[model samples]
Target: MTNDRRVIVHPDKPALASSVAARFLTKVVDLLDERPVVHIVLTGGSIANAVLEQVAQSSARDTIDWQRIHLWWGDERWVPLGDAERNEGQAHAALIDAIDIPEANVHAMPASDGGLTLDEAAEAYARELALHAPEGADTPVFDITFLGVGPDGHIASLFPHRSGIQVTDATVIPVRNSPKPPPERLSLTRPVLNASDRIWLVLAGADKASALGLALAGASRDEVPVAGIKGRRRTVFFVDREAAAEVPERLISPDY
Candidate 1:
């Protein structure tokens, strides 16, 4: 099936979260219909986690074959296991904790607990993917990667002007001195993000207006790492009206 990148703008946070959660449910349902198992890469942050919370509240959550679904992280703060700031903890608090998905199927990036350095964690994640993903695939495995754009145009740990944007080999890498707090992180590189089957970038709030403007203006990927993402399957942007207001009004919605 040919997939088209879609842009949906909602009026409020609740509306945006519900809409995104519904779409996620639909996508997972479709994938499950096609195959027994679905592999998804999850993102962290208030907006992305809100989507998961909304999904948990939705009636459709029960329809998903949670057991057959596999989950991975797009990036993670390099903190000890169970750190409140950790993406794994955020996800668990929002949805995973409520769901019946097998613990073994949830592939969280390495935490500091395993005597693994950040680089070692990245390599370990790559090995895990190699073991689970199909042979000859573009990069390990991921049916979809959910991304959240920082106000400064960062995605995952590939912050603007960071060297992780240039990574080509390993799908995941350790990042140091990140612009945001908790300086250290592990992130999926641009090459890996570009290789994903689908990418859904969720943006909301008024603070993101300026960055959205720069991205739509055809900013260089190296300058705005979020803009660097190009997926082979499909790419989509889900933004609130406030966040997308700066985009050319004409491109805001084709239906308009």
Candidate 2:
């Protein structure tokens, strides 16, 4: 990993999730000590869900004020409100429902049945971001943004060689024809994601090795969307040995 980026390789998936959960709790607790509320952007995937579960099981989980935490999604499937495949739904099942966060504090992207067109939903989410954003900023300065990388090197809904990856003006946009299932989705644009103070990419599995390697090797954003992501303060990739298999030895740190 470069000076601006760091990689933490765990022995296995369970270990990776546990370590990330512990660090996440620490970060939230530390930030809450200095501020009234802490904002976080969450992602969806097997490993992402695993981390959430770990957080829920943590002994320190109750120390942080859940009601003072604001939750947001980095991306969401444009499905019905409670669809099984929807990221927001899965998140609620895995963590939200187990916590005390107020309904107003949970900012989920609009669902398809919300009486808004896909474009309209995107616009609405952008407006929401603008409303919560810090003064003089187009997006919120999230305390931390958690994301999961696709095997295709995509981050959020920005796929390689896609229009989402090329967009430069919008903070949120509607995505169509995603290489993965549920083609239609809503995702925060690169600028909005980069507005965060820190970004944590939680990844696992051998299938992701090639993409992880390419991203760490400085692949272009247009070719590897994950490569384009950088936080204002720090960017860290938490991966298990299987996922880090293809990354250079110099970039893989076992210290975590």
Question: Who wins the TM-score comparison?
Answer: 2
List candidate 2 segments past 4 Å from native.
Answer: 1-3
CA RMSD of all predictions: 2.0, 1.5
lDDT of 1 by residue, 52-134 (tens): 99999889899998999999888999999988999999999999998999999999998887798888898898888778867
Please give the range of 10 consecutive residues that has the lowest summed lDDT in model 1. Answer: 1-10
Q: Total backbone clashes of model 2?
A: 1
**Which ranges of candidate 1 are over 4 A from the true structure?**
1-5, 254-256
Clashing pairs in 1: none
lDDT of 2 by residue, 108-127 (tens): 99999999999999999999
Estimate every model's Cα lDDT from 0 to 1.
Answer: 0.85, 0.91
- Give the per-residue Cα lDDT of candidate 1 at 11: 86
